[model samples]
Target: MPVSLTIIPELNLVHIIYSGQVTPKELFEETQACYQRPEYKPGMAEVSDFFQVTSFEIGYDEVHEFTSRSKSTHGGVDIGTDICLVGSTKVSEPAILMYEGMIAAKEIPIRLHVLPGYPEALAVLNLPEDSLKYFPEGCHTERHLL
Candidate 1:
């Protein structure tokens, strides 16, 4: 799989890394699975890394679909949190922007930040640059799929 999710309960953070080419289905599945995990708390900050991603097989329709699914599954509650999107190259920027736009349009109350790299993500979250050292080593899996 090209996508993985890592949840760091200690930091109240979740890191999602997308590599190669990613599809909406894979992303949705991993995200839904993350929600089911004991470590996943509402309003946890997220770092979504697309640095290794070559492309995203997503579009307006997919964004709409995912947004709907997310709202329904999460019960339309305020899951308000900070989300940092990293490494948005030309190939993946559109998808990232579309999702951010959708979230705004729906009044989701999330604070979304689009940055060039993880260092910026850390800074935005007020975490130390070396904080990544706390992430579980080899925690990448489709299920805790980082």
Candidate 2:
């Protein structure tokens, strides 16, 4: 899969790594799975790595719909942390812009941070630079899929 999601319970963080080309279906599925995790709290911070994604198949409409659908489940009232997006790929920026727009329109309680790397993501979430090691190097994403 091109899109993957990892939820870190100890850190109260969600990590999404997108490699190769991404499809809308895969993105939505992984996202839903991420939120369904027992460790996934509303106020948890997130780091999304899209630098490896060569391209994305979804457009503004799909992005908007995806976000709209996510609203009922993704946000938690106590969501105390900001959502950080780390994407270096060209496709990452436009998607970020579109999603930001959707978030603004919906007035979600989450602060979306669009960055180019995990270092900036950690900084945005006020986490230590070395904290990344705490997260699994493997596919920690699937643990939340069920």
Mark the 10 consecutive residues where model 2 has the least summed lDDT.
137-146
Residue-level lDDT tens digits of model 1 in 6-123: 8987778988888898998898899989989988887788888887788799999999988776556544447467889877899898998898889878767678899866667777
Where model 1 places Cα greater than 4 Å from the true spot, the runs are 72-79, 136-146
Candidate 2 residue pairs in backbone clash: 43-79, 43-80
- Candidate 2 regions exceeding 4 Å error are 75-81, 135-146
Q: Please, what are the lDDT tens digits per residue for candidate 2 over residues 26-143?
A: 9888888877778787767778777677888889888888878757655556544577886556777788788888988887666888775666666677777567676555523333
What TM-score, to 2 decimals, does candidate 1 have?
0.85
Task: For each of the candidates, give the backbone clash count.
Answer: 6, 2
Models 1 onward score TM values of 0.85, 0.84
Query: How accurate locally, in lDDT, is each candidate?
Result: 0.78, 0.73
Highest lDDT: give the candidate number. Answer: 1
